[model samples]
Target: SCHPECNGICAQNMDSTSCTDPQTQYCSPYEYNSTSQSCNFEPTCVDNCDLCYNTIECQDCSPGYYLTPSKLCSETCPTGYYPNGEVCEKCHSDCSECTGPSDSDCTACVDPKRTPVSGICECSEGYFENSGV
Candidate 1:
């Protein structure tokens, strides 16, 4: 049975029901606790996550953060990865920071000898491009 206002019909199951505000008449999302037969107003999404299906599964990230492949939100991407839109993408092998995956897309170089020149990494002075290094 539901509250008097609901006329014995809850929007969801008896164990789980949406909460409505008496003053504003607004409905808020809630989680059901079957054991207690009560609703919890706790947020379902994790911190830094804007959209999520649950506490640990994020679908989108807040500003300044990105959504990882594992559905976690991270402030910064790991090495060899760069923030692209709401996710992190792989960087070129020679680039520590880049906007894209191509070699010419490098914003920063992994090796000190290689310097960013017009978005591409170039060997300094006498230094030569070595694949082994």
Candidate 2:
């Protein structure tokens, strides 16, 4: 019997159910358990992780955290980090997103009220910006 929630096809085994596509690795909010050889229904991600597989291994992270190339979730990225499609990246101090590490390399401001000024962004007149908001 195949799983009802599986997006792709699922193969039913005498011991358990497994997803046929290895590349997709999807099982409708669940992962195939090789240990018991079944589809795991319980959640088992580390702190700050929203989706997990292989027990403690994270497939997706909570907000403010990003999934790394190594499959770990981190609040910040390693040096020389660049965007890799919803992956972790370190932006310039004054930028939400940037082309380079320098403050003047900012491509966008973190705050909507602020405008880019000489590579950095600051609040326009009559507006104030604060950090760690």
Candidate 3:
């Protein structure tokens, strides 16, 4: 039976046997409860229960990444930073790829004394187009 109509009972006529609200009432796009014994509303589950940037809910990790229950969904580490303890981490500004903590995964084009923009080595001495250290 429809809600508030048959008082939640289906009559022998295959109808609510009483007044029941028809599905056309609200015109919902889709109802998870179509064949429901009674007229009750239900909710649908979405992926991952949580959402993250650059990541799809209930999905696998991208390359160079791993999945962990403690991790935020679809979370990504910035370039040069590796995944560590549910976050991305990088080595020293000088070393590449975990040579040591605080060391960079790749050497800087310019010294740390200079300002940085876009991870491209810029001139502290004031120059550009740096190939490597």
Candidate 4:
């Protein structure tokens, strides 16, 4: 038997008998409760998730978040940060952004004290360009 509104039921006429398809039904994000028989959404995934199968298991993430290799949604891994498997890590002290963990790997510098000369940041005016320092 389906609900009175028939919102979650698909009725098919065959040989004078009506058949209801259970798989055709869909539930909203807030109404996906596994224990409930009705098409209702339950809060299963982590916070800021657009879609998830259960608590702590995210299928899709909301905006400003990135889906990691482990399937977890993270907001910390922005443009200048690196994923250290669990969280976003800061690059070198001289770098505003970097490809690795060294000063030579810097993509850009914080400026004034250090300026980006090529791909790396060098000491600007009033400071000597020291290498291997």
Candidate 5:
């Protein structure tokens, strides 16, 4: 008889109903037959094993600061700011220190002592302060 059978159905010819496994949902184990009641196999998820996006990068932490678990860029301590290794920290007033990202690392004057109102960016560690005309 032309009944919806597991072994074969009229799907191709316009009479067979689509057959699939109840668990996996894949086509029945065997092709649609005349009188089968069960599909033999199940469908499964195939891991693509995708890779990370190229845009994402692992930048280094800013100076005076340490990298966190979530690899992100951070600013370093400035003249006044002091990071406790983990993060940049604010220095006491009057103390001139530097802070900010390594790229634009900041170095500002704290309280107590006044910053050279004029050309204060004159001295470095090893070099003496340059007196510009």
Candidate 6:
């Protein structure tokens, strides 16, 4: 039997009452509004999200964007973090930009007084390391 809300068309399983197909029936930008029992054209996903279950649950990102663990789409990773495939990974504390998580993977230094030397951030000639007092 078809769901009463869907009229004569079955949105999902014939025995079920909710619409789960967001691709065909509702398209990517629309979502099934259970309360109204209708498809609504809403911005239910993040800006750069290509696919999502809802605003807070992004499944994939659009081109030139990456998906964060928090289910958000980002164009670029924040400082102290680097892009790893489709996700952002934390960099070493001393690195402003790095290829990996280790300090030795540093491509840039967070401090102007320090410089990247052999993939590591080291104190420059006119600077000295602080004891963190």
Best by lDDT: 6
Which residue runs of candidate 3 sit more than 4 Å off their true CA positions? 1-50, 53-79, 104-133
Measured by TM-score, the strongest candidate is 6
lDDT of 5 by residue, 8-117 (tens): 33334223364232233223222323355333232221122111111132223424434333333344333455556564455444346644333233344433333423
Counted clashes in each candidate structure: 0, 1, 12, 8, 28, 0
lDDT per residue for candidate 3 within 1-133, as digits (tens), equals 1222333333332234443434434311112133654324432213332322122222244444534444433355444445665444554564333422442234442255544334433456655545788
Sort order, lDDT high to low: 6, 1, 2, 4, 3, 5
lDDT of 4 by residue, 1-133 (tens): 2232332443421111332544555443433333455655455567778875445556577777766545578876665656564445667787887766677777778665887666579887789855776
lDDT of every model, 2 decimals = 0.66, 0.62, 0.37, 0.58, 0.35, 0.70
User: What's the TM for model 4?
Assistant: 0.37
Query: Once all C-alphas are superposed, what RMSD does model 4 give against the true structure?
Result: 12.2
lDDT of 6 by residue, 9-122 (tens): 344533335534433343334455656655566557778887765566567788888777677889987767788888788899989988888999898998888899998999
Model 1, global lDDT: 0.66
* Model 1 misplaced regions, further than 4 Å: 1-41, 74-79, 130-133
- Give candidate 6 regions above 4 Å deviation: 1-32, 36-43, 68-71, 128-133
lDDT score of model 3?
Answer: 0.37
For candidate 4, the per-residue lDDT at 74 reads 87
Error of 5 at 64 (Å): 8.3
List model 2 lDDT by residue over 2-68, tens digit each: 2434432456522125646444344444655656646667666667778764455667888888777
lDDT, model 4, position 92: 78
Q: How far does residue 116 in candidate 1 sit from its true spot (Å)?
A: 1.8
**Model 6 C-alpha lDDT versus the unseen true structure:** 0.70
lDDT of 1 by residue, 46-122 (tens): 77887553456676788989887677889988767778887988899889988888898888999889898987889
